[model samples]
Target chain A: MFAFYTIYKGYFRTALIVQFQYRVAMLIWLLGGIIEPLMYLVVWRTVSEQQGGSVGGFDTNDFVVYFIAVMLVSHATFTWIMWEYIYRIRMGLFSVMLLKPIHPIHSDIADNIGYKFLTLTVMAPVTLLLAWFFDASWRPAPWTLAAFVPVLILAFLMRFYWEWSLAMVAFWTMRIDAMNQAYIVVGLFFSGRLAPLSLFPEIVQRAADILPFRWMLSFPVELLLGRITPRELLIGIGAQLFWLLAGYLFMQLIYRAGIKRYAAFGA
Target chain B: MYYFRLFATYVRVGILGELEYRANFWINIIQSALDLCVALGGIAVVFSHTDTLGGWRQEELLALIGVYFLIGGLIRTLIRPSMIQFMEDVRQGTLDFKLTKPADSQVLVSIQRIEIWRLVDVLISLPVLGIAFLRLGASLGPIESAVFAVTLLSGALIIYSFWLMLSTCAFWFVKVENIQVIFMSMWPAGRWPVNIYPTWLRAVLTFLVPVAFATTVPASAVSGRITGATLIGTVALAAAMLLVSRWFWRVGIRFYSGASA
Candidate 1:
């Protein structure tokens, strides 16, 4: 474990330096991460205020806290591997990753961690500004706050493995852009970025509950905001573990299939 | 006549190039469907909570969404793909080919590429816009139609200039493509009326990224929400942005060629 830790430390340090060098790209990327949640934040808040101060169990202030927490949690668990894979496969860069002794995901995981570290400097301050701007209201239970740590880590791993498995589709078709877009659209809906799950229809909420999407992102935010009850928290953790395991198995299957194809086609 | 002939030739060539990639057409259709699901579905979800948001009715908001997709389609079809190519040429040091053309470099770069399949989005959005109008029972007078056309033209020109200015920065900054993400990130904001946002965000949408002019302004014209002052301001801003971007492009080319050195 320590050896694994040291290897990732090296990757993180190098990635941190490279990310720092392109400081403007870093900032541009952060804008995309924050703006979606912020836009939804404004829209939902407006709807709540217009509907006599609250709608569907969340007032304007409650939404303010919900979206701010969402911004942070989404940023933490986000993975760009799907898009990166398309580019890498197009450019014949995946061959280089395959040549490495260690699994390519370890490096990707390290880079993800490194990027989160850099962006949090900006995201943290932005969150504060959003909290101020929206008059966000929340008082977390200390126990729920403690549970947030494991849940967030699980969320990140679940999303990463799932997206990484999706990335392996690059080996089958170089043109996975459409598929990736479809995934993102579904992810956006099921992840509760469109609205809090409570705001959706019973059918939509049930589908979101059964799927891995909510557990990967929105569930962590729900946990952090104390929106999850004790029983629901246990169920949420079970869902996260289930998805994480499923994602791990999916990644193994897809990577094997992808490797076989790459070996045959030599791209 | 020369410009017309040149553009006709480009259309033929672009169509030929697109024909070879038949898969892209299917992909375009699928992606467009998914986009509609998310966009109109979100509107449905929002309206489920309230009747009117920020004083705009549901039909008006649909018109706004139609404008978003229409302008967005146009950009993807002609403007964005061409500019992305121009940026790539800059990175690959092949922009000299564009410079060597008899026509102006900006004009050449702007008309260089077209993903004709992206017109699918425009075709799809037209019906949505029509549905919105039908729902509103909007009767179009000749003057209202003219105002809508004028606003849309000005909006397109404004967006083109803003994007050109942004792509022009490529001569100095090699990775200006990342900067394009700023426009994409802010685009969904235009799905709703800009007035819904805080004053600070409204200013950002209006002035910084120009989404207000490109989408909401034209959509407002269509929905009979545009004021005389807003229409005049859009035209004036479009004209000013064009001139400024043209000037900036010249400066960029000079820098690229080391003429300043």
Candidate 2:
């Protein structure tokens, strides 16, 4: 326990120092994160208004609230480590990382959390700007708000573990571009980045419900926007827990196999 | 004339280099096919819900997709790879070799690297465009066809200039590798008609990112939806951005070469 805490604190401190050095770049990235969801919010709101107040259930204000929630959930859970892993392997940084006493994932988790803490300052104001721009309104029940905390946490863990496992594929393949593209394309469809799962066809919605991607993003956003029923929320949480376990097990297997490959290849 | 020969040489080298790796040809084909499917899938989903997206008919939007792929191919083939190499050179301080060359720096930098395999995007896009044109079911007059060609050229120039300007920022900002991420994020918005976006985003896509000219304007010309004013404006914007990018490239090279000292 003490060793884990020491490694965690050490990684957190290092990430903070590195982020401080490139604060402006981090801010630019934060600006980009702000723009995408805001753009979608406005487009959906326009569509809803044109359709006489709502489309498929979500009204203009519902879109505004849902998208803002999505912005926060996506920011909280998203990982760019797949691209970073490709770079680290290509540039020989992975070897140095492997030599460290601590596991690399501990440092990545610490870095992700640390980076989000720094960027949330920017995201908060941007969220407020979006809310103000769209005149978003939401009134979540106390139970729903209480349920949101654990759902968001599970969503973040599931996303981080799944993407980290995806990144491990870089250890075995020099050409991971095709894999990356495929991952992103599927992620766009499944994770509710393109559109809400509810707005998709019944078949797509069912697939999203069964997959882990919707839990990573759309579930939490829907919960926060008061768009989910209590029964649905319970099912969502149950699904998230199952996927989290699956992702954890998959990560363990992949990491062990990837490390063996890396050791054999001497990289 | 000299630049044409330089481009020919670059293309030949690029093709030969790519040919050495046989697997890369298949990979490129798969990647391009996946890209086409994604675009078509998005269109299918949208049309399934509604007949028109932000006033664009299905056939017209198909033409827009063709222009998107065509210009996308042009960028990947020539502009993106070269700029990426130029940025890498800046990072490694190997740009000095290019600075010593006798040819114009901007031209050389723009054509220095090519992934000849990206011609697949062009090859795939032509058939898509032909099918879209046939679906529109109108016999395009020579005048309209000529206008579409000119607009396509202008749009290409605009995109080239905009990308060159962004890549030139590498001389000043070494960490601008994520600039491509910003561009890629914005490119998806282009997959839809720019008019679908709100006013501010429309303005940004037009005046700021200039993606509207790259895909939409040429597409509008082909669909006979373009106005005289919009056509002239696109041409003027292309010319102005070209000059501005050239000037910026000169300034960037000066800073890189220590001429500011």
User: What lDDT score is found at residue B228 in candidate 2?
Assistant: 98
Score residue B196 of candidate 2 by CA lDDT. 73
Decoy 1 TM-score against native? 0.95
Candidate lDDT scores, in order, read: 0.88, 0.83
Candidate 1 docking: what grade?
medium
Question: How do the residues A173-257 of candidate 1 rate in per-residue lDDT, one tens digit apiece?
Answer: 8888899999999988888888898898899889999999999888888888788999989999999999999999999989987
Q: Ten consecutive residues with minimal summed lDDT in candidate 1 chain B?
A: B252-261
TM-scores, each model vs. reference: 0.95, 0.91
Off by over 4 Å in 2: A31-39, A264-267, B90-93, B169-181, B251-261
Report the C-alpha lDDT of model 2 over A30-60, residue by residue, as the tens digit.
7566666766675576567767778777777
Quality of candidate 1 docking, DockQ: 0.78
List TM-scores of chain B, every candidate: 0.95, 0.95
Worst 10 residues of 2 chain A by lDDT: A258-267
RMSD of each: 2.1, 2.7
DockQ of each candidate relative to the true complex: 0.78, 0.35
